[model samples]
Target: MEREHFSRQFDAELNDIREKLLEMGGKVELMIANALLALVERNTELAVQTIAFDHEINRLEMEIDEKCLEVLARRQPAARDLRFITLALKIVTDLERIGDQCANIAKRVKELNLEPALKPYIDLPRMAQAASTMVKEALDAFVRGDENLAIKVCQDDQVVDDLNEQIQRELLTFMMSDPSAITRAMRINYISKCLERIADHATNVAEMVIFMVKGKDIRHTIA
Candidate 1:
């Protein structure tokens, strides 16, 4: 009876940690969306709010790390359970970094808003959307233990990369044409790079999920 009770408690603790990770993922996704919205709409208030949201993401990351450590010390989980806990620790770090990228993008947006409008902002928003979708799907795959969905997330990263490259090219053209537009163009370039980095982090999370599900280390393997 005591053994069964201990098993039940351990499972419950793992489940609670998983839920917290998902909650953190959701908040990060919103931060990305709002950051892009602020840039496209020139909404400084929304940009400020998005920057403020990073505090919660940072806090949750610390809390999740503590829970994972407690589980490792007390439960001494093995096999897949052990893998899950370690993956959770890694995922939270990626999520926290994604939050940082969002904050960076928000800060750039505020700067851009003070200046006159750049171009139509066509590619940056698309890149942000793709990166955010990858994050949401990757987290969903982790929760559902869906290896295929996670693989899809890895595949989707190239789209964001391509968009980022296109934005850089377009912005470079703008800077070449008008010296006065150089500062604004560079800021937009930085925002594009931030979104691309967010996608890269999401890819990292998806790779970890694939490892957790298949017991295979497919980090650098071709899709």
Candidate 2:
């Protein structure tokens, strides 16, 4: 009976951790969407909204960290549970960083209003959406303990990287063609950099999922 009680408590704690992770992921997704909308629509209001979300993301991250520490001290989980908690800690860091990047992009969007948009914002938003989807699906895979889905998320990161590079080249061409576009083009360049960072965060989440499943680090290891 005592063993069963401890088991139940451990499961409950893990469920709580997953819930917080999902909350963080959802907020990151909103940040990305709002930031992109701010860019495409030139809406300062939406940009401000994305900036606000960064605070909430940071708060949730702290709450999750506290809960993880409590579980570690009280439950003393081992093996798979230990791995899950460790990975959750790392995942939250990546999620929080992604939120900051979204805010940075939104800030850039707000400033771009003074100058006409260099282009219709074709590739950047698409790449942000794809990165957001990868994050959502990767977290879903973690929730379900579905290693196959996690693998899919890892594969999707390559697509995001390709899109990011495409955006860079296209923006460079614009700056080269029109000397007047240099300033706005540089702003767009930073936005693309933020998107690339988001893709990197998504890849970090994928790496955590792999560690959770296979009990391997595999972080710097090339697949």
Predicted candidate 1 versus true structure: per-residue lDDT over 125-165, tens digit per residue: 88888999999999999888899999999999999999999
TM-score of each: 0.97, 0.96
lDDT of 2 by residue, 102-158 (tens): 999988888898787677977887888888899898789777777788778888888
**What C-alpha lDDT do the candidate models reach, one value each?**
0.94, 0.87
- Candidate 2 clash pair list: none
* Runs off by more than 4 Å, candidate 2: none
lDDT of 2 at 197: 83
Error of 1 at 124 (Å): 1.4
What count of clashes does model 1 give? 0
Give the worst 10-residue stretch by lDDT in candidate 1.
Answer: 214-223
* Clashing pairs counted in every model: 0, 0
Candidate with top TM-score is 1
**Cα misplacement distance, residue 184 of candidate 1 (Å):** 0.4
